[model samples]
Target: MRIETLGINHSAQEFLAEQNITKLYPPQADAVKAGLLEGQNILVAAPTASGKTLIAMLAMMEFLSTKQGKIVYLTPLRALASEKFSEFKKMEKLDFGRRIKAAISTGDFDSVDKESENADIVVLTNEKMDSLIRHGAEWVDKIGLVIADEVHLIGDKDRGPTLEVVLTKLKELPAKPQIVGLSATITNSNELAEWLGCKLVSSDWRPVPLAEGVFDGGTILWNNGDSDEIESSIRGPPIDLCLDTIKKGGQSLVFAETRTRSASLAAKGSDAVFKFLSDSEKKYLEEISQKILDNNEHTDLIKTLSSLLKKGVGFHHAGLNQNCREIVETEFRNGKIKLLASTPTLAAGVNLPARRVIISSIVRYDVKAGANKPISILEYKQLCGRAGRPQYDKFGEAIIVGNANSSDLTEYYINGTPEPIESQLADDKALRIHILSHIVSNPGIKGEEILGFFQKTLAGLQIRKNTLSFSIEIAKKFLLRENLIVQKAERFAATEFGKKVSMLYIDPITAIYFKRGLEAVSENNAHTFGFLHLVSSCEEFFPKFSLRNKDYETLSTLIENKSSELIEPISEYDCNRSLLALHSWISESSEIHLSDNLGIESGDMHRMVETADWLVYCLYELAKLAERADLLEELSTLRKRISYGIKQELVELVQIRGIGRVRARKLYDHGIRTVSDLQQIPVNKLAEIDKIGPTIADNIKSQLKKVR
Candidate 1:
């Protein structure tokens, strides 16, 4: 079917043709026929890469052609938001004659971009949009359409509540924007469509066909009862499958359960990958491998990844830095890398697809359960959906390694339906945070209104109304006890501190934790490790460093020595280790050094620092609220020190934009210690310092001038 037949604008059709996307896939056609172009609400639940994005683009263009209001495209991940932002920004280049401004916002939850407020279309992560709504951005009232990508993540435990509450709140807005939810096929999509008040278009149609099967020994028993014999050239099942796929002229994707396993499998499969690579390919991969190494800190993981990339294999996980992940993804998309092993993070929304996907393990470690649990059928389907890329392969192959439980695997995964997405909004922590946000956003909200708001949620629809009401009451009671909220008669209002807490995007519990820590701190009690422990103990800065046996011994000794100054007696090893890690970081330890000494990945350290910095800022904000002048000065210093990973003396010097820890140390060593010294130093002399280029020197001078 032609894209023009879907009632898209002439310019949009021309743009599609320019990109060689003149024809609509079956799912796109179905969506169009379901009134997607007429500004009607739609739930498009289809396979991955089945023109779902094009469907969204068509709807956006239709809305833009007739409406004056803005369109908000919400994605689940920051990476996906960025990718979609690039795709949507191209619409501005089309000959549509109108200035369709596009903007993207991510990471920062406290502020909304002014450009996005005035944009014709804005792409943002769901959390960013939720934050905007909480802060009561004026432009949200002008929104006429909202496109929620990966709407099925409404079942995710950590992020689902945010997306669900955001959707429910958007629908309840007075503007009543039309919503277009794109999702992978889920079992209860009909119920979801009913909840969203949208017409459903659920289809299994794909741009490229997918063949799913179970591999046991050397044979693949396909879903259709057909069998294929592929002997293993390698010992491991994952490597053998990868080798077989590469021999068939197809790139492979291996999905392991854990980050460790992903790297291990990739390393084990590197030799087999080398056998398949040509000399030219090997040379090109070596260059790419060197680029990866150059872009990252020289850690053991990076060394392993760099070596494996030379053989056309690489491991990808959240542990890798953003630059390394991007390099691997880009190279794989360009067909430079043959096999990539990754955790399920790659299966979520990233557009890196492969010709064949091998599921090395069906089970994942559940931290809360403290055991390995089988992944849901929905997760399995998501991994399988990455098998084929459109316009690249005739068909995709998704093979699950079978074992003694092969029959059950074939029944439950190969032929099974995806599980229904359930609402996780009823979680206590999620409810507490969002409840504060809702009240702070609208201060006059009464208890009844709060109940009504939650009643409109998916969780309210799934569970009993009284159950949700009880949970809301519990959150309200907790907030009142914490003094974050004050109740008068039937109306609930956020206290001044509570309003700031919501605005700062920190959890109410985290705010309470900071308040307690601040109350415990005095001139004699205040210590660096004490404050670090308080920040690490908060729920917002969780999944802290896991304590090894040696770490427990070290932290135990430290805790015994500092028990009087510590916020709480160190009972949890994880919390103590987190403090130790932060201490090392602020003590000017390099990321590579931290990874080697503390067993913390560079990426994890970066995450910890980012979270700790925000929490310290929160502590400073609380100190000011409490009018603790002495504590304020101390926390302000701590915030800067943690933010830059610098010493007390270098804090002021690192305040300049171009001067980080290393540059600050260099400037101090060169007798250019303070801003006054920086003002007296020549730009050329400053540039001559180690790691400081002329551009940075100029930037430092420019920044100093502005400060003066």
Candidate 2:
């Protein structure tokens, strides 16, 4: 179907033409036929690279042409939000119907975001949207259309419940904005569509067809009845496949079950991938390799990743920092890096696709189950969905490295139907969090009203009503026991503290922990480690490492030595690894020290630091509310030190923007220890300091001048 014939307005059509999108994919055509442009709700379940995003844009432009509000595009990840935000920026040039403006809000900060309310389209992460609803943003009612990319994530155990609740809230909004859900193919599309009130536009269409297969020893038996063989390298089949893809002038994406495994696979493939790199690519990779090393802390992990990039290989996981992840993604997208190893982060809507995808394992370790679980067909399909990239390959290939016989592999993964999308809203933690949020947002919501809110949730529709009601009662009891809500005359109202906790977007349980810890410190003596440990021990800690056998003695020694100073009694879920890591971090330990001593990857350390920084701020808020005024200065100092990974002495100096730990320490050594100290130096003199260039020096002085 020609884009011009869709009657979506001339400006949108011309913009599509400018991008050479003259015709629609068949799935997109079906979506249009389902009255997508007429503002009806839709659920588009199709393969990757199948024009789902284009369909969402069509709905947005069509709705905005006649409506008077914003389009909220929600994603499941920060990177995906950024990707969609960048893509939506092009629509700003569409001047045919109404002028388009787009803004992105994905920060894990609390704000009403009044400025973003004016945008025609606002892109956000699910958590950010939920936070906005809690903060009661004025533009809540102004949303006219919602585009939920990766809508299938409603089945994800960790993120699914939040997305489910957010969608339910949007549906219950007075504006009654239309919803457009895009998902990879799932078996139970009817269930999801029914919950969303959607016209299910499901298909197997892809711009680049995919061939699913399995790799055994030296043979790749494609489900299309095509077999390919390679002389296997001692480094194993993953490396051989990397070489084979490179020989065909295509790239390979190797999916491992763990971060350490991904890194190990990349390292194993590095030597083989090196010989295929041309002189020019090698030189470019070497250049950026050094930039990566210079730009990040020179840890052994960074050095290993940097060295691998020189060999035209890269690995990605949550353990790598955002800057490093961006480098790998950008270079991979540009085809500079031929072989990429990653965990399933790609399956969460990252746009980094490859000509071929190699699944390094058919099973992943489940920590809770204490066993390795087979990959669900939905997960397998998601990993395979990245095999194709439009306009680059005639078709994409997905190969699984498995011990299963060819037929078994084909039956299980290649021809298997994906699992159904089920609601995770009944989870105790999810229920506890959302139930509090509902009462806080609705203020004076009754017990029945809270149950009513659950009825509107996906769980309410699918799970047994009695079962769902039981979960709600338990969640309400938790909220009441934590003192986050109070019963008054058969209705519930969030106490002032409860309202603050909800607005801060923290778990109700975490708030209780913070309050208890603050009262403990107020009545006793504690050090920075204890305070840091208190924040790290919260329920909000993510990307946290388990306390391994090796970690036991080290953490036990610390706990034994600091038992008097510690606020919360240590427990298994208290997260000893985070306590030690962040304690070491605020003491100015190097990244290598963290990795060597704590077994933490630099990426995970940074993530832990980010999580701790936010929780510490949450601690500060709770302390203020609890009237522990003395702890405020300590918390303020602790927050800055954790954020910059610096010490108390450098905390004041680090307050000056653009001056991180190293620079702050440098200035400290030069007798510049605070903003007041910075005022005494000239820009040129400060510029003479190592690593502080003229621009940064000027920035420092300009900041001090503004403060003055």
lDDT per residue, candidate 2, 1-708, as tens digits? Answer: 888789877777787888898988899999999999888999999988888889988898888777788899999888888889899998888785556788999876667676577788899999999999988888888888999989899999989999999999998889899999999888998889998999999999888988888888689998878898877878888778877988889999999899888999999999888888899999999998999998887878889899999999999998788889999999999999999999987666578889899998889888789999998999899898889778789989899986857689888889898888889889998888888888988887778888888898889889998899898888888788778898888799888888889888888888887787777774546556777777776668876667777777777777778777676577444556777888788888998898888877778887787888888888888888988887888888888888888888998887788998999989999988878778988889999999798999999888888898
lDDT minimum window of 10 residues, candidate 1 = 567-576
Per-residue CA lDDT of candidate 1, range 1-708, in tens? 787666667887888888998777888888888988888899999999888998889888888877789899999998899899989999897656677899998876778778898798999899899989988899999999999999999999998999999999888888899999999999999989999989999999987899999888788889988998887664588778888888888899999998999999998888877998889999999998899778777989889899999999998998887888889999999898999999998999579899999999898888889999999999999999999877689999999998867778999998998899999999999999889999998788899999888888888889898889999999999999989999999899999989889988887878887888787776655567788888887788954756777787777777787777675555645464678788888888887887888888777777788888888887877888888887777778888888888878999898788788888998899998789999998999989989898999999899888988
What are the Cα lDDT values of the candidates? 0.87, 0.86
Pairs that collide in candidate 2 are: 319-603
lDDT of 2 at 323: 89
User: Residue 479 of model 1: what lDDT?
Assistant: 96
